[model samples]
Target: MSNIAYLGIFGPGPNSSAAIVSDNEIIAWAEEERFNRIKTSPNAYPAQSIAFCVKEARKLGLEVTSIGYAWDCNSYSELATANLEQTIAKYPSETDHISRLAQQGLNALYNPTKVKQDLGLILRKLGIELTDQNFKFYSHHLSHVASAIYTSGFDEAVVIVNDGVGEVASSSLVYVDKQGTMKELATEELPNTLGGFYATITEFLGFKAYVDEGKTMGLAAYGAPDADIMAVFDEMVQTDGKSFHYTVDPRFRYSGKRTFGSRFTDLMVEKLGPSRPADVSAMIAPYPAIAYAAQKKLEEVLFAQMKYAASLNLSKNICFAGGVHMNCKANGLLAESDLYENYFFQPAASDNGVCLGAAFLAKIDETGEIPKLPSLEHLYYGPSFTDDEIENVLKQCKLEYVKSDNIGRDVAQHIAKNDIVGWFQGRMEVGARALGGRSILANPLNPDARDHVNRHVKNREAWRPFCPSLKKESFQGYFDTVIDKSPFMIVATRIHKEFLDVLPSCIHVDGTVRPQTVNKDINPLYWSVMNEFEKITGQSIIVNTSFNVQGEPIVMRPEEAIRCFYGSGIDVLAIGSFLVKKGRR
Candidate 1:
């Protein structure tokens, strides 16, 4: 039967979710907050996300059959040690909220019946039938493990997943075997979490906890790593190689509430005095220093865990999908190290990607083989519009525009001539990084391209480094020791000094670049464009940055691209089947 059997819904949190394994592919997949956009904890149900999935399934000409959540918070993992029913009864107030919010928020895990009700409402919204037999729950970390190890194109890989607390599981290690099957080596429940520690440090620095860690990562590149604070982190984080534990520097802990604790804040003050501090009057330079210190320490502990995991699993290759793996710089360090011969971090490393991971996991469970690797050619996963749709927006806006010349070729020539051109193609990508599909391309030789990009297009923090999409053949010659193959712009590796002038913009202050190695096999059009530019200019890579300016999402529509073209300092814009250039640039 082509009818979709198993379905799963995640609410985009470090909470318990549900998953079902049916005969065919993942029947329906979605997150709760993609519908509400407010997000839910694991205990919450994906009512809205489910509705959208049902709608999408209708588009696929199928009716959903079995519905499963990604969580067996019903069983036990981090959320409950053993008797989940008893645990909920132990916390009645939280349990009451669970009842009311089960359909929406993830409090369902705390209260089992609420979880059942949450699933009930999901089925109700779809106007579909359900059964106690149809309702199967999953363990949160098990879902995480299944999502990564099952899908990665590895016969055997050591898997690591970590995110905000779920089932009390802050970390886990999975060993996917040669048969495309895996077994859980061990799972680390919280009170010893790198993610938990990162979250606390994130909020301590005046940002939202789980959400602001990227901000802190960007902030870290600007600061100095103080030895004292380095000492603090060293003493606090203990690692056994396979997993880690974080003991907050008891002398200066703040429940990790504020961006800067009295002790940490004070340490910042003592180490690096106020740099232009009349505004806030605290030691600001040291904040990034502390952040750098924290990030550096976290990487050390994490790599230690990775190394231990490699040893335990005895897999030369390691595949990672977790919140901790989101730290690309740390990934870079791992790439440089000899711990794993091959390492792959899932592009959608965050929780949002888990939906795909869950579906992939279910596929793995059935096939017992690494589902054929979907070419990482591009990340064109979001919505796309047709010419009429684009033209309608264009006509409605009354914009001056005509579809221009051979877009890919002309833009390639322009890039060869050292011009910055915004190339918006196919669809916007699904993750944090922008691949070639939606990017700005330029000749990498221009030493001034970095500042030019910052001043004109990005207007982001000057210190935030630029990324390069390098030709696969020339990759090793231009960059020193680029062992990791990250077409996703996730790992930052160094630019060899001998070739610094060849691709100046791609080089960071620390002389590293988050390189996206392009090959005809991986991303053909993008590769061709870069290849054509390289042939003309004698340089094999292009300075590629996201196609959006500061304080804005990447321009989605053609008119938006035209608007950005005129408003920003971009010399050219590549719309589909056309080239639009600003006059007198």
Candidate 2:
């Protein structure tokens, strides 16, 4: 039989994305935000991403045999309707507005028919036909689980998924046996969600709910946990102290009319004080304290849930995915714990990653047997440009540039001279991180590097930390952690006390660093640059932030990288092997 290819789409939500898997290997993966230049690409159909995946499939002479969507909307409808009815019964006064919002959400999110129609139209535009028989939808939480466990290269592992509501379930504990059969051990359903709680707290602290939760996680490091705030959180969500199950107070989340807003009701404001205004500084005392308390509570509750998962005694390995797993601090806590002998945290532990899972499920459904595959080595599965393409863009922009005989050494020299370089290399990375493919590089030893990049390059909050991309050999020397490798920069760990002052720009206030440990075999070009930097500075690390400014997706094309280079304070643009420099010292 010929090889089978499956196309997966994750969309009509934030971070809409698409991916293609063929013969048990991922061919292409990309987010719609990168193509549309919208941050997170909320509720946007992933047409451009689908186009990319199709093009990549064609290049490999593979036809898409099936299409899989990341959500099973039909599974969510009844529970959603019942929840809405309960909410209306509880708050009769706000019934009208609540119903209106519910209807809007249904039309936008929970309508599978609309998604099918949109996919058909998009496929038709791409010279492909979509049929009901060839397309299937998988459960959202199950997709999250598969994204981690399937790519983990483990025959048997326990999977934990935590996110905002997915078909009524917010959290799930699942066990995958040696035969690749998955058993649902337990689940925490909607109205009692770790994700919703975190998002509500994020929004309450003057940040966007889904988009800025990372900001809250970062801000938490600056404040001491407040007992009063912790007490308030205890009232909102409580565990049984023996199981993975938990309960949420309906008044705080998605239940009824609020004194403040839809995310939180009068009960929350009455207990936690008024929500912070968007214009006010997030660095304010109470805000940080609130963030700290929220982070601590999240970790405490999550640890309890995982401890229960371990007690089930199913497997020695554990895998994690979902939007909530993107919290590196919480992931760091879990990494340090002795709950599981081996752990695999999905790099793209968000809705976008569901495409990978959906594709894998489709493959299993089509082939009748699970394909044994190697663990994911890297995420460089998106678009790439040749040297000719970079040169053409440079010539069109009328910019002076040069092809470097040794790109790594040249870039290293610029970085050592304290120049901020926009480094756009081979295929873009699939996840949220820059990962050397599309990165802005700076010298981490430069004390002013972090502030400069935050202010002039990224145009974001000064308190936000920049990640360090270091050689794999350098990981153990700098960070004190059990994680053997962190290629995705998704887990934060404490830096050694001796090296804390050495990497001033890379170390966060908490003395922890989210590092991308670069293996030479996976990315030789990036490793070569770090190697060259080590030769010059005697440290095998460099500051690596995504190649985008505030409120924009990471640069995808050569033109976008050029635009960003000229628009930002970056002093140099390294596209492929060619270099373009702004007139600077």
Candidate 3:
């Protein structure tokens, strides 16, 4: 009955993060990459992140009593060893089993003993005891599921967690009852993972795998999936009612040689032609078409898998988690499907969110009760800077700045004048997308906004589309879609042709857009800025992109934001209540 403070830790891999839960409420959460300024540190521990959570909790008069590690590698080891042994017996010539065994020996997925020691060291540094009674571990997929279902506020829902690889299973389907009891029905093990398949294709297309999948999704709208490519993907995966299996011609499957140099790339090339060079500047023939084909195939397989799960679970509400759920295009299909009445994709759908899931799972195990938290109303749970912090950073850099009473309206007015502004306010967001707390803002109506951002600020592909953050009430006026409340920018909805020219900066080449619906209650300053922009231009949308350069992680601290403002092509910066402009002293 007493408030229990639980700390959740995820990763020593990509998208590592930490979260703190006080009984039924999440007090603070943050990804490690945000604090470290690294783009998903695959091998870094969440020491700084965990320390931040503890410090943040103390500020709120709470003490973390237990730590929940987000993965039980020992359980995964048992399952994987058995499964691989079975596969080796069944397929004598296949090398996937051997390669996977090698990776397992390296403890790529996890190592219980090693991780416990590391956690002990980190927790002790934070003045927490390192006892077995104070630490717990949850299975990877279960943690992913809990993150979605517990925060979803759905009494019962069909839970699906799909990612590159969790221990051994890449995807899992489960049914959660109104009492928060979960029954996992099926799992798709490694080598057969859709997450891996998509990552392979993303790499083949010259973008970073696991990181630039959004690029591939955006490019999908530009071309149609070739029937031949679809045939190849169809041959790679097959599904039954309750589960799915992979038949990727071993020659085309992952062999653990190079990240992108797999039999999979060769097979894709055989089917779709040579892969695109990563440095290519133009959206030429075959690449965009390949992206389209790959995305379409992914949607087809994922949708079929979802259909099978829905047939078995019979839940009107669905809670989605994992890396694959980050695919907004695929999410759009699921959202529009007639099988489910409502679907919720956690804002932090990637591995970065597993920390939250792990904490919730630990809470449930310790107390035998599901957290009584409401639906995830907002993701602004990370650290927020004080006005003094922002002013100190500005003064340290000797930058001329103006403090305004109405920062939102002042920033919005500058954006209306065609200047790209770095908007940093309140707590930092926990997900990959820059919702509002930390974002680069521009007038979506400006004809040159997209190109300027891509070429100068982002230094990424021009073909990639920017997202629009519009007031929730103005969503339907621009986009044509049935899935209404898209607060996370997870569903790529069709942009009304009439508004395409008006907000061309945010529209993709395929006429669809990923949009974040801003609600006043969740983010008042962001909503106010959007409203101010609307008052000036009669358009309710603004171009919203992560406030960082191409390869860097989103800005977290005030110093990082200030450094980024000076380093990039951003013309103005709205940090807390102060306004900073380029080339001014």
Candidate 4:
């Protein structure tokens, strides 16, 4: 293994993160939101995340010799300026407005020298320093691709990256051969993005763009096919079945004054009626149908792209990254299809994963080859607390708690009793999903469990469905699907008809569920709790959601867990080995 250590920084935007790669392995990875307690941590510098990575790297006797940033600011500046100029030329009347918007957007794109200065400030704050020569800026889509392909454990694979404009490309298809050679096969440039199309609809439907696209995904299941809505969406994004390219109509996305407005234009409001009010219930007729149409269109275009990628037959294995791939419903369809013999989805497929991707790119740049690495097993790559540390927090808070002789059994018993539990175990998960590391656990059999948690704890949309964390062995029995393992909860599958009534809370209105199959060896404590729950209730599944209240990031420390336990409707706080309980709900 090479002795060189590389530090990677993702963004000063949403889902900012940092990672350290050394000795051909990821030493640490974390998102800024987890440390800042802000959802997505937009515009945050990720200083805390970098500090954590540095501390973790030090434990392994490693020091960061170089740094990699996820974006090539120079390329982005040139492309963005050109795109803006073309837009202004197309609509001469809105030149001033378009130019102002473009200036604001361009100013926000990372400037290499400014980024180096910012990094120097952050490093100095952390009692470390590095020269400007150590920094390298890579293309955004390349980082997204690297994050998936390098950790996919596949010698060869076709990688598809789709997101809201990375540099100039919104979607890219790259072929990775056995020789580790990467070839950019096809790309869909800006203004023709699947992510932009979805985000536009997401904002129109009264949900925050980017942040609440998943809410739209969940609402889509409740919506039936609507001809008018589907037609409108069809007009917005046109896909060619024979090719990997698609065109998004600018009028519905970022055209004229709409670029400075709510992303969607007046034409969209005229076609679909005025945007849904934030206070209004999303369950209303046209809104759900709108979400459904948008989702279907996204899937349609995505499947076309994937099918084209497969037509090349560069490799049977396929890997996906970028924010758009976070749509588990689409991922589920890809998983069920015979398009690929094997599939790997990066858990942190969003910009948060770019840090790790940049770090890998730095390593490759240094070594001149992609390093062979094991497939990413679990996302327990964030901070972890010891029992002693947890106990100290408990004592400081003056909270009554008991150290469990068997935490798994104890937590399972509470869950069996229909109690919502905050299960804070080892390291926190790195992605949007909590997995088992930092999750709220509940009995899946209780039909009201979903509503109870949403009303009292999550404080979000009641129609949104909760996911299930099931034992790996029980996957085939509960879900009818060809794909066997989905450890990250990034794919949706249909629940078996017979078990529908048995695990009511876990299944969505469409009878589909996003499940995380827990391997015993990968997450022993989590597996043990499910195992014990099975022993008690004859069911090996539990409803698992991220351990956080509405509008907050998941808990990262014992204090945060304790605060969440007391602040919300969660019944028990099973943090580390200590169990703190409240009066039965």
By lDDT, is 1 or 3 better? Answer: 3
Would you estimate the TM-scores of all the predictions? 0.79, 0.97, 0.95, 0.97
Q: Which segments of model 3 are wrong by more than 4 Å? A: 1-3, 85-105, 240-250, 255-265
Output the worst ten-in-a-row residue range by lDDT, candidate 2. 87-96
- For residues 1-585, write the lDDT of model 1, one tens digit per residue: 354544565653542233333443433443343233342343345565566556656666766555445545564432443323433354333233333343234443445566677667668767876667555555656666666654465667788887755566777777877765567776666445777677756655555565547766766776686887777667656665444333334222322222334223333333333322324412365577767877887787778767777666478878777777778788788878777777777765666566555555544444443545533444554445566676676667665566755566677898776678988776556555678767888777888878888887776555566788877887787777748455788777777787776667777656677888886775676787877776687777888887777645556557667777777888877766656666672
Clashing pairs in 2: none
Output the worst ten-in-a-row residue range by lDDT, candidate 1. Answer: 250-259
> On residues 1-585, what C-alpha lDDT tens digit does candidate 4 reach at each position?
455678889878779999998866888999999998889998878899999999988887787877889989766676777875675566444434755576567556576677778888998876667675677889899899889998999988999999998877999999888877789999988678988888998899888998999999999988989888888888989987778999998767666455334678878988888788867899997999999998999899889988998898778899999999999999998889898899999989999999999998888777677867788888888999999999999999998888899999999999999999999999989999989999999999999999999999999899999999999999998889998888999999998899888888989999899999999999999999999999999999999999999889999998899899999999999999999999753
- The pairs that clash in candidate 4 are none
- Model 3, span 485-573: residue lDDT tens: 88898887888889878888998887778899999988898999999988999988999999999999999988889888888889999
Against the reference, the lDDT scores of all candidates come to: 0.62, 0.88, 0.82, 0.88
Candidate 1 error regions (>4 Å): 1-7, 12-63, 66-68, 71-135, 179-181, 205-208, 222-225, 240-284, 361-378, 416-420, 482-484, 549-571, 583-585
The full ranking of all candidates by TM-score, starting with the best, is 4, 2, 3, 1
Q: If the candidates were sorted by their lDDT against the true structure, best first, what order would they fall in?
A: 2, 4, 3, 1
Using lDDT as the yardstick, the better of models 3 and 4 is 4
lDDT of 1: 0.62
TM-score of 1: 0.79
